[model samples]
Target: MGKHSKPSGQSGRTEPASGVRVRPLPVRSAVRLGRPSDIWHKSALSAVVAMAVPALTLFALGRLDLIFYTAAGSLCALYGHGLPYAARARMLLWVVLGMASSVGIALTTASLTTSAELLVVCASLIAAVHKTVFDAARLGPPGNIILTFITASAFFVPQHLGQVPLHVALTLGTGVLAWLVCMAPALLRPQGPERIVVARALDAAAGLLRTEPRADGVRPAGVSDAWHATSAAVHAAWRTLYLVPTPTPAKATARAGLERLLMRAESVLGSMGQEAEEADRLRAWARGLRGGGPLPGVMLSAEQDVEVLGVTGEVSDVRRPAPCHPRGVRPVLARLAPGSPLLPIGARVAAGCVLAGWVSMALGVGHPYWAVVTAASIYQANTTLTWQRALQRTLGSLLGLLLYTALLPLIHVGHLAMIALALACMLGAEAWISRNYWLGSVCITPLALLLAGFGSQLPARVLIADRWIDTVVGAVVGLACCVAVTNRRAADRIEVALERVAAAEAAASRLLAAGPVSGAEGAREVGWARDRLAGCLAELREAVEVASGEWWQRALPDERIDHAQQQGHRALALLVRQVSMPAAVV
Candidate 1:
């Protein structure tokens, strides 16, 4: 057969002459905005309460000079939103310590260096390190950028060597308080975060089901997009449940129930006829979980019950043992070595920050660190995201400035009153942030201004003018760096990830084909392969997303990657089925 012609035995279309299976070009949506998330209220409430503790304490003590450090520490409360309690506890502890360490470093460095140039360099390096470490660990949103912002901003605060210990103490103290405030919700609702994960999965599954062809046989516009999204959500839910660290009997039971619910959702995906009813049931269960009420039991049909039973049996029998991975300094140090994907991001961030700082200083901005922070905040995993962020930051800052101007007269009433207004803005910013970056910025801009004026009163006009100028400067400098410093390896990384997925899927496929061995050793191998395949798929998806966002890059192997993923998932499903039926495997 000719290269472009289908082979005689093949049932599908032939590959192209060049051996590329090109897909239709992706259409760019005019509306590239995100919807409001349900967790916004929780996140906003957490920030307000966490910030309030430090602000109220400092206000009562009349130590406004130390308020910034305390507030900086309080920001630590914003992390680990969807993590299980055990995981969240560990994460929050690290965050608080990390926040304190950043403050300590800032204070010590500021004391040693009076030169603005040297301080800017130190801050840039710190920002780079923060970016690298946070990315490596996958700490999620309100991520290392905020930590860098707080630390870099601290460097600009006038500090005496004698005051270092006190400032550090304030940061540590408030950090501890913030940790406590974040953990407080666990007392009332121990499984809230985990339930949220399940709820999200259910909602996503419902969305996927809704995209199925109607009874009249009409197809929807974005059914393929919806399927991909739902797949991601289901996988996320499984991963979340897997990592839950359920040490107690009650927690373990809850975890198992969540697993069953997820399995049912998956089965619903496979059998499209009952999509709406199943979707509604899943949503109802999700709502019950969120409301802290009795879970509405989903009555499965006989076949579904059998499927659920088999899945549960498999889960109990061959759940993979968690692997021992390097922790702490080891993982962080590993990322700094040559060829780490995170290294490029770190380099870009450092360059952007240093250039922004220098430019801000040249412009004689009163707070150059603000410009530096703005620049640091704009660097996402790829240039496209960076472009979006720069736009969001600028637009948000502008609106925020307007809000600041309107609130300035009211804020000028008293220091305590300003603190109250700042708190309100903090609440608003957090509430709106998940909806859209710009909306969040509207509150963040005014909140930041209020925070800066904490210890001393500044002329509102000058403050506003400087912020506006610095914002534009930072946005321009940041976007320039993104264009100049590209992650050329992003596409290559996706290729490598695809290879890993292929390997993993092959291993699992071999196990499924080989019939179950009698010993634990075989089960362990099968489990490991399954876990590795899942991880690789997740990594591949992330890499593809990042690569697709790069401008002026080579055309990505989108069809190839998609084909591999689909095959891998099918192999995984087969492996899962074999696990369910040990006799068939044997």
Candidate 2:
């Protein structure tokens, strides 16, 4: 792989590629079972607790009609579990407010008009907004689906002008409770999120260490994947640790211990050879991070502390403020620019939601909002993922219909029974959805149906028939829009990503040419350069994966991409060597 020009005379495969290959439609991978999130119980437990208290209270008061509003608030608990306490608190605040605002808008719109066409347009636009904002913010997992679901459902509910505030108030109030529930764990273990992230870095580094070294002076098949995964984990650990405030000594000490563990993991990653003992030690320390008893004391001497190469200056200082990267409102506004790639996704969501809802309504489906949700849920970063979601959603929605039918007997027993049953479904949805959307959908579909029957109970036949129709219509229409809407900017993003990697690599090269770095200041600069290049390479990989499946996009410069990645990683390896083995000449 040459940098200036591709293999001109010859055209053939030579080296292993690092980016995730985009298959047309990965049906098996989409439907396949996978490991759950490491902290699945956090979201699962919080969602149940958040719902049960309010739902049971409403049930006792004969106010089950307001269950939807409280449920909307309660679902906010499902987010921010992976963030540090400081970050999580801020994130959850915005999420709760966003959820309430979404529902409030829906309620307001429904109160103003009975026009289905108008409602469809409003819902689609809101879905687009939710999708766009959530992606720009990079709030992981469940994405905008929950917001979409609650908002769309609200639009169809019978609303009067006066009642909107009360309903929205219920949502905001329960959302407050949810915020508390999620933040409670921080009190028990203030360093919980930081510890978990470090543990993850350790595990990822250990996995990389366990990879057998290649002897042919050529890249191995899975080595790049392992390398990128390890790199991402290590960087994520650093970012999370940087976000944690260390105002007190105890907090500072906990932060320091986690930093040492992370440094060890990063060192292991920088060392390209297999070290079985080192890998075992990392895993041991990772396991020790399970509970909040004590930090894993991976001590570093004063001399070793200066070995903080490949770190940002702010990160080099324990008391420094969070990184200066764009966050909160600024980056989100920038991402919402007209020419942004997210615009196409927003376009897809808007088109799909409207079309799905319209078609469902034309068919006289009982609840067309379900179809709207199906459309909103399927739009992923690329069309390949969108197709997969369509399939998984279809399968799960159908299975969930069956589950709902079985539970109908018990649910009809009383309002209390229905409330209990709905809570169970909520629990299962959060727990299982972490592994695969469809598995969770099996539980989720029923929960939605039960919630729909809240104010006025719909018959089993009507509920089943309505949801089935919506699911099929939504999947077909949404997938059609995904493929039809052209995303011409996908390839362009890859190009920009490539340029970033090139610039970062150039800076790193300049640092490498400065001979062996010494002193805290010089080493810190080297570390920052390394981190910049590593982050750029990671972005390039993401851009490649995203562009791979886009329709009607410019042909990707595969050779150029491969060359950049290979050369960039080669530079990184040398940079790591310079940092880790200062005595060895590159």
Candidate 3:
């Protein structure tokens, strides 16, 4: 095949060299624009599809009020659901719960008191804490500021206590419609193609680690692209997994095994820092020779042919090197087994139970419609992400409210064109403004203004005032909850990650110790080990950062963990170089 060189628009921004014309987006601009191709397209597709059901339902019933509920509820399904375990499911549940709870809280407060400003502030604060703590607060990109509209506006929403149940039921019915529309059609059956892609990723990462860092070979540009593709594939796979029921024992087992193998490969490669300059060049040359195609020959052992590149006509016999093993490595090598333990059913059950509780409580409260929003925000694979999201929600909402208050009066409420303009702004909010929390808030302000317009047309300034007050309340409350509900201790999480690293390093050591073997099994073994080690190293770094942050609250033995992690990093780097090119003879 022919070679094509192009930049992969990946995350981590890098400066363009002097001659390079490609200009990267500034972090701030990127965050503000919020890559329409990434978050927006995914979310808007869900939202637009979901809107169909409600629009049709309202068309049949001739009740525009119901459409509002439908529109609100359906928005729930437009979030990031296809992420790894706990993240999608948990966040969705939180959004639903948060929406429901905020509705009730806002309504109750509104009904009991005449202080509209106070109620808005109180509601915003409560929503913020609820979002922050439980991870269920799903107010969307601009955060809980939308809740200001839901709550403070409840004062004038024209409803009796008796109508609460029916209105809530209507809203939830729409929400369910939204949920079905979001998930039912697009999902893959059995396993997604992404899974196959993930498997391939495991193979690619392994290849990089096993090769000695050499300067002789032309670096395969594809290597960077391949690694990125793998990461995206893994992320996609995990997201899809969370959306569905937990995998069966067989599937889960297979996945676990693959995960372990990949981990081992990562660890081994990580042990090696940058190799000698000549070796690096040689490796890069080899990569260039192999470019635009599958691996040349069965698998090249690290030692065989120092010549990196070869003519296209002669693909076979590229270079076959002997495998490398570490000293006294048998015990560690044995651990690189294929097979994963089945995921616990109890975890699934717990997740479901938590989801259900939040849903029920949200619906039971006065402003139950807000439940959808709450349920969506709270679920996360790690509590750290959940906390960050919570803070974002609180801060974003406050910002949105302030913006709304200032801008509302500038727009005319009576003009239908203005309403249309507001809707357009909302779509823009949904389309952009996802990169950073505060930036998204700008879009959210107009969206809320539009949503509120659905019910009544008060003076822009008055509506703005109410919005700011409600946002304040929800943000405060959501943040408070974040502090209250904490799980998955950071220290413990770090320790577990270290343990995994240790296990991977040990296995790679053993593999290196074993003399080189020819044929398929030997190749497979080496490939698997390489993959596992690389993953382990990456995860270790992630775990360290997470643990460090949480250690502040829980007080972990930071010094010990830090020292161990640093040692692991050094050892892993060395190991990578040593194992890059396998030797033929023991």
Candidate 4:
């Protein structure tokens, strides 16, 4: 995609033994709109309320100038929406800490120093750390953008040593509030998050079942996408259920019921019985799960229920399912270890952010943090995804400027008007961002402009012009850094992923060879193998897809990877069938 990209050999010829095939940027899907999340309102409402409470408090005290600090905490509500309440609680607390820490760092830096150059350096490095840590922790959407924005802006915001503690305390307080707002839903429906995901799994599995089976009963080849979606959704649903901590007897009972529903859903997805009819049943169950309704039940004995949860009650006293900690700190730490792809991305972020911020400062834009944030937001999983963000951010910023221009008059009417408008845009960004980043960006741009209005007294035209210039500068510089920081290790990651697939396939094949055995225990063993192989294949596919987009990576064995995936899936299907028909085998 750039000057740094290594040329593959002649077209239609074998690549050099050391070379991997680079994937072209998929521009179409990058900008394409996707279906909105089923529970998007959870986030939209959380953000609006989170922001509104603090805004109102500030307005009453005539301390709206402190809104910038509070905005950092309010945005914390945006993460962990999809996590199980048990896991969400831990993740939200970390998010709260991360938000405060990020703000504190920026505020401290600004107070300790007055050099714009030094601030740019400090903010750039912080942006890199934010990018790396958040990606590593898997703290989902809004991702590091909001955190980076708050930190970068805090760096530029005028701060004095005396008031540093006050600002950080304000942010810390609001972060606690954001955490409360996010966890409030758990009080009403303890398993609401788990139920929603299970229903999504049912819906996705139903899509897979909607296709007609072949005469020989094999799945049609073209329905792989549906199969993949179903498998991923089911996998996620199972994980969510597993993550539900049963601290109390009541919570354990709720989890047990959820496990039954998920098993039924899984069985329906894997069944060979009337596809259309099974699909309808799955959809019916899914609809029933949408509210505080009774869990759709399946006919399973107490022993069978225990088995399906991957536990052997006979050995429950001696052996138990391994515990998964709510705070997933291990993976977070691993992502920063030597040879991680995220490290190189962090390098790109540091370099790009510094360059972008420097250019903006040289250009005399009052808020170079905008440029730093623009750069930070553009670095996604791969260059293709990064390119998409750049396009989205630029276009969104332009359209957002137009939006801000239109709303400028109302914003000028009074403080109440400005506050109301900012709240609406905050709500809109969360509502639309899930569908597509750019759509959210349109609302985000104006929201940003208004936040500036709260912080400084810059004229609307200067804010508009400076934002436009900084955006263009940031996007261009960020892309350059992406090209410059080529990750050759991407190919290595794909190779490792392929090895995992081979290992999983071999394990599943050995289990399938054991023949279908009697009882839930045997069935559970086979089911475990099936899930493992499916997961490995999913990872392999992701690794390949990400590597393909890189300009520099070792040559991929395309035919070998395809064969591995095909064999892996075949093994998975056999395991699934054997586990589903667990009775009467050798």
The whole-model lDDT of each prediction reads: 0.74, 0.81, 0.44, 0.78
Report lDDT (Cα) of residue 270, candidate 2: 60
Q: Tell me which residue pairs clash in candidate 2.
A: 310-527
The TM-scores of all predictions, comma-separated, are 0.87, 0.91, 0.50, 0.91
What does the lDDT come to for candidate 1?
0.74
List the pairs of residues colliding in candidate 1: 516-585
User: Mind giving the per-residue lDDT tens digits that candidate 4 earns over 379-477?
Assistant: 987776788889888988999999999888898898899989988998888788888998899999999888889877778999999999999999999
lDDT of 3 by residue, 263-322 (tens): 332332333333344234333433432232222222223321212112222222222222
* Model 1 misplaced stretches (Cα beyond 4 Å): 1-33, 213-219, 272-274, 296-337, 512-530, 573-586
Between candidates 1 and 2, the one scoring higher on lDDT is: 2
Q: How high is the lDDT of residue 436 in model 3?
A: 62
Q: Comparing 2 and 4 by lDDT, which wins?
A: 2
Give each prediction's root-mean-square deviation over alpha carbons: 6.6, 5.2, 14.0, 4.4
**Model number with the top lDDT:** 2
lDDT of 4 at 386: 82
- For every model shown, the clashing-pair count is 1, 1, 133, 6
Considering only N, C-alpha and C atoms within 3 Å, which residue pairs clash in candidate 4?
Answer: 19-554, 19-555, 20-554, 20-555, 20-556, 23-548
Models sorted by lDDT, best on top: 2, 4, 1, 3
